[model samples]
Target: MATLLAGMGVVAVTNAEAAAGCKVVYSVPSQWQGGFTGNVAVTNLGDPVSGWRLTWAFPSGQTVTQAWNATVTTSGSQVTATNASYNANIATNGTVSFGFNGSWTGSNTAPTSFALNGVTCTGGTATTTTTTTTTPPPTDDAMAATAAMQPGWNLGNSLDATGSDETSWGNPRVTAALLDNIRAQGFNSIRIPVTWGQHQGPAPGYTIDPAYMARVKEVVDWALADGFYVMVNIHHDSWQWIANMPADRAGVLARYNAAWTQIATTFRDSSPKLVLESVNEPQFSNSSGAAQNAELLHELNTSFHGIVRRSGGANATRLLVLPTLHTSADQARIDELTTTLTALKDPRIIATVHFYGYWPFSVNVAGGTRFDAVAQKDLTDSFDRVHDSLVAKGIPVIIGEYGLLGFDRHTGTIQQGEKLKFFEFLGHYARAKKITTMLWDNGQHFGRTSFQWSDPELFAQIKSSWTTRSGTASSDQVFSARSSAITDKSLTLNLNGTSFLGLRHGTTDLVRGTDYTVTGDQLTITASAITRLSGSRAYGTNATLSARFSQGVPWRINLITHDTPVLQNATGTTSAFAIPTAFRGDQLATMEAKYADGSNAGPHNWTSYKEFDRAFAPNYTTNVTTLTSDFFAEVADGARVTLTFHYWSGAKVTYHVTRTGTSVTGTTS
Candidate 1:
């Protein structure tokens, strides 16, 4: 956007009679990686204003984290800020001021272009200040603990899932085994969303039932014992009372105060690893529009924070999570929540928001399963806004609940692979920004009864992004081999994992530069210096390609191929293997070429391969690639050459091979 020289500021005077005539000065008082704060002073040159809204677009994907002296909201790069009650009026020659905190990726340049009520701003150059060098505020214990919570998971549908009882939600009774499984899955934190409405006594000193409270405590203890940070919140109370319903406002608060007070007091002696979220998503239907609803939520949060602190013991310093209206990521809601919470000056206060961005795509229940660029942008923009609004302000943010809903509700067919990709990216992005994210598990993706996941692939996706372990997408990846294949030049293999860190051949660890090179998810063996086992020949015969990772079990790809090869000299004879239709666009696994005497069988590296591209050609069923191997010494024809194809974790190849002249022919298996 627009940049102003340091210590330089200008005030432009335009035709005062023009209806939209107004001069605005925009400046950045401070900025840091991923966030910045800006000030805008609007001067009325045309006429006095009773109300106003200033709008502008950020050249980069900058988003408003929080604003003061105005109500702020953003759509993509465009920002809209309306006057607060205190700053609504401006007279000709008079000026009003508003400021905001925003976040940006890559660059934090100020927007050079600006508009006031759709009218282009004129005649003012910006002034920049040297980045602040002030020492940051001392982080409280709660803040530090909250910071430790990255990549969280929710015990959804089991505790807070809709129903009269826990089992009513289609999930088995909560057990220690389940909690152990979660902790073992690399999740260091768990958010237990509990619906306490039904478990509490009636009015006039309404009390939470002791039995239900103990049940909650039992589950909580399991989480703590498993070394997981626990966050227990009052969930689904809004459906019963916690809302903007004027008639029930007093009663709702009474019950809310009583429930939190009791729960807080009971866990007052618990370790600091336990956190208390004020309430689940609070619904607002106040007649006073967004402003009033925000005020109502502000009051609710303030009351909740106060009650918890007053509950005593560890409660005073315990981390507390607060949610905005409906726990929404809307810019207006974030602005309201940030403005309200910042005033509390409580270091332990964490702002909670739920992410289900671009409902049609992220949570599409109408059979939509694609997660393309548009969906990615939705996630990027959502995280950016919250970062600018709260995280930049030193307030830790917790994505209380986030997930791509059932891929196809009617049929069991879900775009599981794509969904796993989304999870991987979400966790990766969240970890980078220091934003803690919890996956919403409701006995759908995971089977509580069997204590197994319906899709282990999906579980692996989230596990690979965890921060507790050295493993993550940014550094290392862990996954089982899907398929193995051998080309003439090098060994080609496909994996369920996206990134490559290191590889091994069975027990022998292979070096990166010397052994293999990785591109995206494919790993290609480089040097032929791999030493063979005692029983194997010079090259790996009947060998397996294993990988070493920072976490999880090492993955191995069995390299096998069936095709007759003509014994050629140094120029190795090419053994052609047909690509399967399902793997037309996918990379092939490692392939092995067997010697006619059964003396040796080594991998053949596929140097050149083609991916199926509909744009490149129509009616293309399979993309064929030629594979080569240096293992070809001398072989006899019609000697019953065997080529066994190994598949990836989720890939299956079907093909039959036949020798034609000098080349081997491959057909659909």
Candidate 2:
């Protein structure tokens, strides 16, 4: 990247550039081929120019590489740049000025001449600003989101405010000032989840409670002032808004269209920084209730892209996020639809993916075990799965929500150490893979809020770095690490004062697979990745092992031999379950450890236990790391069937499927 420091007054900021009519039109910004900023202008000078185009001849060195908003087609010294489809409707007889921002390794100088519609324009020279702040570039989505920040504390409870006692988040609730903390922490975007229904007036005339919305506006206004990419979406208003969406014969479609129209138009002229996400997690289908819900969400999807595009400005070119049924990680993979977003013509259809492959932990069981080591590889080979698919047909993907949720339910203390480890790992991997991710912190836990951070013991542990918090892998460093047990099968390796997080060899014996036996005293067994994701037990100071099974329960001290390994020292909770509830609907079987507590909570702590169980059913199978189709063997061709819906609502229902190297079409009963 090139940084050119110009003396004062070298850069011009005229009154025309700041005028109300000066709309700051779509002079799109592109990726930084180099780091620098400049000034220039093109005037109409009274003669009306139909459909304006900018052509500047670089002085032998300023060859255009890549540009956005405007596409540049270069042939030698003369570079021709034109407004991409969305920005083609520029007016004539009006002076338009658009500059570029990029990097240059060679000498930085102003382009010698500029031609507007083949006619030479004046004021050809400008200043180039140099910058030294070179932070790691964010994934594409991150850049777009950070670019959309409408600075403000998320109106978490207030937006959905049944007006009960305000359930404030982050007690000095996230305000304008909180933005500094967000930026400092390397976060690039903020998504504001809103509920317009509760704030609507007594009448159904689309007249929302201006005061309630104003509170939200205050936050967006702050974010805009701070210059961050902000996204505001309809969150959790489905019951009263999306779900209860009139399930009629014909009027339903009209209501849906008018609703989004009002929403899109209301925020149309706001600011380029504000991005409108179509909807939140709208549940479409389960085993039951599939038709109406399915039809509504489908129509919503078909309308969102077009609706936001019609909003204009950045909204026209602005990135729109599309969520799927249940916002399922696998559901977002649209394998069955021919046109994932073909109905819309906008170039900025950013397919939205929510992280929390294990949502049971984030919400239902907040403060679960740290999955840093696991959430890491889950990104590798799968990034391009959805984006590439859409891009081929013309679309991109963005990871809008992801966070290491380690706020313990029992203690309410944020599991900072392990959770941050998860974030740091995902952040690095996400950025490297070119996929952006937003942290899902409502400021409730994770050593951020007052109540949680109040504990001195937890605070100190959370403040310290779990793995190196350096945030970047230095050159010559062995980054992009892919670690597996020297063997992927079951085994216990000791840490042996190795400065690593593992068992000590002198302190633990190893198992190779999942067959264990107890012959009076000695324990014997085998092991596998299934066993690896499960819990284990400590046999002695120098030995650790898995628990033996006695009627499907761990018996403690499982010694796995090539032959007959056995388990010893069995202990059981006094109260027993009529039937023990284990991990269900788990496709990958990421992990499992027998956890039971005195409070009668299931498996409070696995501490040292045995046996990870394979889930019997999976809603959908995906590569946990890259989250795409078939991280493993593919589902047989005739084995799958999809159910599509027909609704009066203006939405289209699509199911993502990876049909191998070919295509397959069929229907469900």
Candidate 3:
């Protein structure tokens, strides 16, 4: 059974009893005048346990105010801390620790005893450790390793590009200088995705081309030499062959194992900084449901684990990353990966998932143009789930790729202000959740040839988010009507923990009271300032102002002066129909087209508001709105459809169009 030796201050439990024997270390790592931070480490010394709960009674009157890595609650002098979802299992000799901030009065004393799983802990010790210090985790500590690789970047559309070679995707060849530039840009790690199926031989061998392998090594070596934690993975091959695991299980598994065998052998002596990901966004085709998919992925992961660990050299202890089905952050996917990780029983394993934000908002479709509450909730919920499911349990998680899906078309698909807010908030929240996020570049963000960011402002916000929060506002644009008297415009500022200093225009500071004023979180620009800034009533952006803050990047505010945009009648063939238009400095937001009976008449018929750039696109330089063939193809022939063009300036214009077979006519009636 179990024996408790009260005089010896120890408890002896037998494995036959299935009771837990544990040791607790409680220390006050830091203390202020009336507050302190407490850290407790629970080490299970006997009988592996799952879902552990540790309880203790405080000797002094200390109240826990906040906690991390555990769910902690206090009742008077008694306190209890339970394992989080992801970290519920503590194998024999495994240690799980958590910390908290508490308020103390006059005196602070560590608890003399602690219990684990209702069994009194033996060898419990309490100390007021004056020095705030932490021992660096061992080399194979995946949690510490992944945490050190924070704020990573993806080398996208290059090696992973589905083509003949690395440069086939239009991005230039990888260069050492590029690695230098990335390091200079504040990225701590780089994920190099290599698509192997196209470069591999057929059948049993499935041998990857030696030259392609060498090239991949060159890039990985460069990153490692630059002191960057590098991750190399099989990218698009997931769809090329791995996804067909259900239909051709043996063949897929053979090829998959062969690929990893060669890869691990090649990088077997590489630096410990190099990490191997089993597969990128692992998936299954023709699977019954989540159960089969999970089983299929588990097989691949187990095989990968075996191949890499047996390859010897650094591969023996190398950090390995595994992805859930589709690398989605859904709870089921996370739990699936958790089971795989636990089955592998490897401490150097990390779970990876990709996030492109909420679908509708990510693509700027269905009028999800703004990063509103729904979108924000989606992001927070996903992160919270991942944090609780993986990170909190001592298992690290890496957001392999994160960005707006619409970024593929172009950044302009989403408004500048909304995009900034999304990135700013994403960076801040990811850091808060203790999860590392890697931006999915795909050559859209950083320019390869120029070695510069395509959008400096967006990059600035992203870079700043790596460290601290940046202030943002409700909207980045202050629209002023050119035909009417200028009125004061106000924007709600999101201080994000920093105080706004003031506003400036091209280096000249605006007078706080005369030109602008800040009351609480509302920043207002005076009417006189708007009138002056809108010099000559320009049709587009008349001026730009920078909102300075105590820290982080400055938020840009554009003063846009515009009147109601005008559209002229035009006629053209079905191949091309460009409505003559004068934007008058206003920007198109969305378009709506409907027939006489109010039925949607565009490509996306479910909603009257059509997808920007897909159905209808505005060409400010050409001064025309071109209705794409996609839109006309779906329109009823010989039926007149009324189109409503909405602009960012809050102005809407109505026009009518009739399609008669090959020809089309447009009118403002």
Candidate 4:
């Protein structure tokens, strides 16, 4: 045995000859005015070693600020990086790599000499190698494989649920028939999120329950049998324990690695269609800032890559997906993942992120009631960043989960028409960018027990977006005043490159010249036709017209006849106050509350317009608008508040409400 002094650290090498044959590759992949990112790969060409350390002296005054995949320490200009617990062993001809963010002034040069366990490296010199390969070269094209997995769906809130079992969430236990139905509905891929923290044994081993492992494998096998691209990941564990990496780095990494190791070994021989994702929405708790979070996620990703690649069998070449911090599509997050992917130098790697539309619009808050310019821009900006950053550079991207955030409570939170437009635009844009999108379904969009879509029309639009772009209109609703004679209604059509076929009502096709006429992008329905369709001019939706296109799903147009809704005075406790409302034919769009002195009231006081469902919700079934406890909790005691309700038909009704301790009263005055 020989003791090796490695830059303020010492290691015992049982066989000194084992470190004789070694090669080190040092490269700076990116650099800024005063900072840069460095990568180092050390390959052991001699006998296998249980533990090893690589040390080098930087010619310039360079200091490492952050590192991942290894424990790195610097003294003066000397840098020593020791293998992490999981990556300490190196088989004959095996390589271990680590990366760090460092700062330098003036000249930045690569280190020419490297020492492994006190022995000078002779196999190769430390040079700026553009690409570093830590694992066997990939045998398949991940780009092509991911491209074929277009239009995916996630089995959300199921195995990923934090409950005691799969059925712990509202979603029924996954069945073969459900998967078959998904395939039948035109989904080419399935993302199965599984939580392991609740099913794993104590520390050290962190062994996952055998029963849970078998159950997860059963789903993967079923998905592969159906010829669907499958992706499995450690889901909710991101918050359960993985997020505590900053507080317990060792324990967190151990459990995370153990979970993935088990997953990889179980599916090592499965079909190539099965993809392994390191983690779901990787994030860190009590982290200093975004920089530290990025480093922690990088550590997890690199560790996952090494474990899967070395698992043998199909995993050696299996497509592995890595996510940015919180799986966000922000430019900074994308750039971070870009560095990780470039450092890994693995062609079989794929990038993933989640999109739930714009923040305000996603949750139907802050007056983001429509898919307006702001929402559209958010979608375009996110996709553009992902495309330019990763997809354009030969790397593929998967939107692991995409949907409206409000869908969690109820799809009705977002108006049906706006929701349709959102999905339609998202589908078209994702396809145009050549990125795969997997709809996040938590037993909301698709009814688990009924085996049907909660909103079939929305699903149709999503399905249409996969193959081609669909034409939409400026507005889905054509409002007509119930007290006045009907007049011609016109809607500007967004052709989206396809020609408009015509308009239809049920089985009867309306005559193009007399009933409706399309001139350029404008479609006009004649007044005579409106009168005929809307017989008696009944309140609410009189008729629903379908505007068909040459391709894709047709746009729907609802003819609504409404009057100014009337509000009735009421009295109730602070816990629940339901204001009697005569909706007539109008549909509620949003509500606004303010104090007598013009100060905003309700939960979100920043904006006068409260959230659709959170602050106040209108029950069309009951013909009343209910103010929740959350709303009254924020209101001033004994203060009269003015409430303005806006309707989709351009009707705004004003009412007054005063809360006194536990009691409340509403007046139409």
Candidate 5:
């Protein structure tokens, strides 16, 4: 009979040396290669742990070449090992639980003695009081939970160079603790990615340096401790993935399996608190070779499912999200996708897509035309298309990227209130449609963890932005509130706590008092002409885009290509425009950004810079001179755009542009 030998202060039971490192338990009747395992329990009745090292010596040659949550290092049949980051930290009182798919070659007998961390717990001690194994997966209702945490946290910014720098641990935050500030300021998730090889040793290939992984684990652990869902993935590992495509068609699956064997094993046993994205925006734009690469990607993802299911720890059934060929929701509907879709033996597989409807506008990758009246509609149209398709397939969708830039020299500028309104509305739309959303946030610039999106002005406005459906019960109102976008149009767009309404050249089309239509993440304002500013002689041209979005994605404005750079002359700004030694004939200006996940989005070459470079003709605009910090010009005849750039934090340079279409030389500082 089992009895409790209770003691005061702490239980000093006999042979207490075998403290459980993992504390999860499970009872599953499954057969290993040699025998059957009906129940298992793993516990971490210890201290701070990055992971664990467990070794089960075997008399026969039954080796563990493949495993998850735990890594294996063998020498001459004497096996030794440990757990990956996810399982390593057997918190003082916390525990992990999981089962493995193993095989047996001969007779077996349960060991009578067990020792953990060099302390031995003799047989016949206390077995009934130990914790079990297994991490419970997230349920579909997860969307409702995060939505309820903090309502107006839908919009986000990508913290490029001026925003953040990479840390040794693959975290983009200038430091690792920023996530707490982000959470306190009201954000819910962080997407920290590592360009694996970029910061890791071993140049540009396999073998993820231990130091890099160690650093990454530290940051990820920090995020989880703060209670935010963390997304860690393999980012621009350069050609680590592209160069290592499966040579033999079948081997593709094998390699994919092996890669995950390492990844899952690394973090599999942690709490069921993080999301593991299979890959980032996989791309190969060069040629027909793109198709071959796409096929390989699908094969890799297919293999990812099995590997994830077999993590062999608490994360065995953890949430696993899969991206499309390039994570494009449109292409994700490819016919062959059905193969992987049907093959989804595990229920945790969530589909992912990147929502950058207004490309140059969202990322400003290339200097394109600034905001247009219909741009917002076009942006949401794409979200609707993807939303409808994913919903029809009965699966949750995730928008990986979306943002608006404040530094476009030609046509890039949106009201602060407008952006916040965009965020609130997007979340409403997504919630109305019952969709889960995660904002891809950069460290700062537009206010990430370091800066507050809901500051003095943005805070009251964000709360006021959401409209409650009157005359309904609390629960129903919340439900209806989620599906509908805020309709108030009189919403003033503020920036850095400054009013933007009176600053524009003309009266904006956005009404002073009217709510826009909201369905899912799509929003449309009923207005004649939303007036926005562009091209201040003191700064560059400013294009005010109407904002729109899909639930689960960042809300953003839209912009088209500009015919000419807004830079008019050179002599007006800091000095006549002269390319820095860093300039390489019209190359796009790019930056590095750190997201909420403690990861960085980088090396982006936006549009306006290149357009300003190749098209500026001095004589047509102002004294045709200087530009830096802000654009300048003489508005006599037709406007001529000129461009000048200044180095700021990193590769990101601030632009000063000036142009005069005719009689219009207002400066934008």
Candidate 6:
């Protein structure tokens, strides 16, 4: 589908329309002696495009050392870059972007001209086009407060660990010089996570030890004195038996109320720069699932909110953050917190979630050497969901604790290039969404005494993302393929796409506009295309229609009906297919597909039924690749078209080869 133009350096499909006014904004986020980070955004001002290729010539002797969101190739000073798979399809008036870290020898000058698909862009020079002003969110106090708290650094482990003594956690004692250095590096906020349970009294009215409380207050004073927004929270108390055990709920609630009451009362007189967080990663289990757990967490959050509200003085107006269950990134978990907190109608309240998303990269666990396309997609979709579900609704979100901790723990083993990629991508993505991001440092990478980071390259990338707002890289376009039955004349999809989710019989790519009138993700099939398919018997009741996710990660969900013999009577078939190895038994689908015969089956399928079927379960630690199922179809034959449906989670290459019978053929948008 990708071809180089005959007489031009452009690469695109020959039959595709050559779009005009393809503007590209180039920006040098940061530049040192011999290296600089560059961000480029390609905006399609004309018709939509299924794919794009950008070509430019670097004026100076700059050579790209690292690139992301697009594949880059440089021959001498000329650069030929193609969009990554996830960003290939760009909608009309929509934009896709990429970034790189490059090095120069003597002179470093920005490129003068740029071309996309052979057409000159409006803003191809070094100077970038100023887009519309990003109006701050409607002036809620909480939103305003969170808006200013961008790109933060957490004082982790020192205070939040088990011991009350900061040095007991292996981190040096807090210092004023450390705070000054942090502010110099572009961090406007400091999140000091403190474990109160370990330092508090036992039983009904658990009181925080005065000296221990003073220690926490001392750290808060240091940050506040330096004019940094300081967020102090009850951290890691859930590890104790009283906090997370169901049998200890009554005693736990009493301790929780007492601890927050004392902490809030102490900070009540402090400046508005001080934010109070209720807890850190509240833990508990329920047999009823996430919804049940959410219900229980709701009670806990309510207690935290009420206790903080009762505390007088500056605490009344100060921003208060309530965490999602376990600080989970799952939409359901977040929705629970958002819905519960929104009903309180507290304008000063904000939501918090941890972003150890894909622990292999974020945690020190084993994972891939590179932050590849799949990781990019996962990051995009996960945070974008937070924006759509919470931020847009007047609730600002804070990724309170996030970073590639795995890099710090496995320094020599993990690639420094991958660490840089993770920080840069995460920073840019957070900037685009205007979400507050904080790096979780536990005295591992960043040294408190020396004011130095073990990985200077990683720190530089984070600083660049924080400082460069005009031309920071944007997360790749992410679209989840949703299913709607094909109507008489039109097939309405979710959003717009650069290309049509193609419809084919077997191997032939259906002609656009002739077979279907396409606009974005929606495709309206004309009578001609329907007539042709009918004549060819390509799409009928007995035919199988499947569409692959063309952007971001690849996923295809098959909803198998319980009535099918595979679930009801057959023994050799499976219900779950292509489950990611990092999957900690998280249920991908809530509603199990019924058998083709209209009978219901048990919900648990893949994890229990098909383990032996997979030889190597793909996980982040081993290969950056996920172990995908070699077999696709869970149901053998006679699958009722109504029963089987496909859904996908954000995973890297979840499906490499699809299973289909003679009558099965579909499209990939």
Candidate 4 local lDDT, 505-553, one digit each (tens):
8646789999999898899999989989998888888998988776667
Q: Residue 262 error for model 4, in Å?
A: 1.5
TM-score of 1: 0.52
Stretches of candidate 4 off by over 4 Å are 1-139
Q: Give the Cα lDDT of each candidate.
A: 0.61, 0.40, 0.85, 0.84, 0.41, 0.60
My TM-score estimates for the predictions, one after another, are: 0.52, 0.45, 0.78, 0.78, 0.48, 0.51
- Per-residue alpha-carbon lDDT of model 5 for 245-295, expressed as tens digits? 534444334444555666787897776667787767665434347557667
How does candidate 2 fare on TM-score? 0.45
Pairwise lDDT winner, candidates 5 and 6 = 6
Q: Cα RMSDs of all predictions?
A: 23.6, 23.1, 17.6, 25.0, 20.8, 15.5
- Give the alpha carbon lDDT tens digit for every residue of 173-202 in model 2: 445545433432223356777766655543
Model 6: how far residue 101 lies from native, Å: 24
Global lDDT for candidate 6?
0.60
Model 1, stretches more than 4 Å misplaced?
1-140, 365-368, 407-413, 467-669
In candidate 6, what are the lDDT values of residues 65-118, reduced to their tens digit? 667768898999999889765467677777887877677778767776788877
User: By lDDT, is 1 or 3 better?
Assistant: 3
Error of 3 at 558 (Å): 1.0
Runs in model 3 lying further than 4 Å from the true structure: 1-138
Per-residue error for 596 in candidate 5, Å, reads 48
Worst 10 residues of 4 by lDDT: 129-138
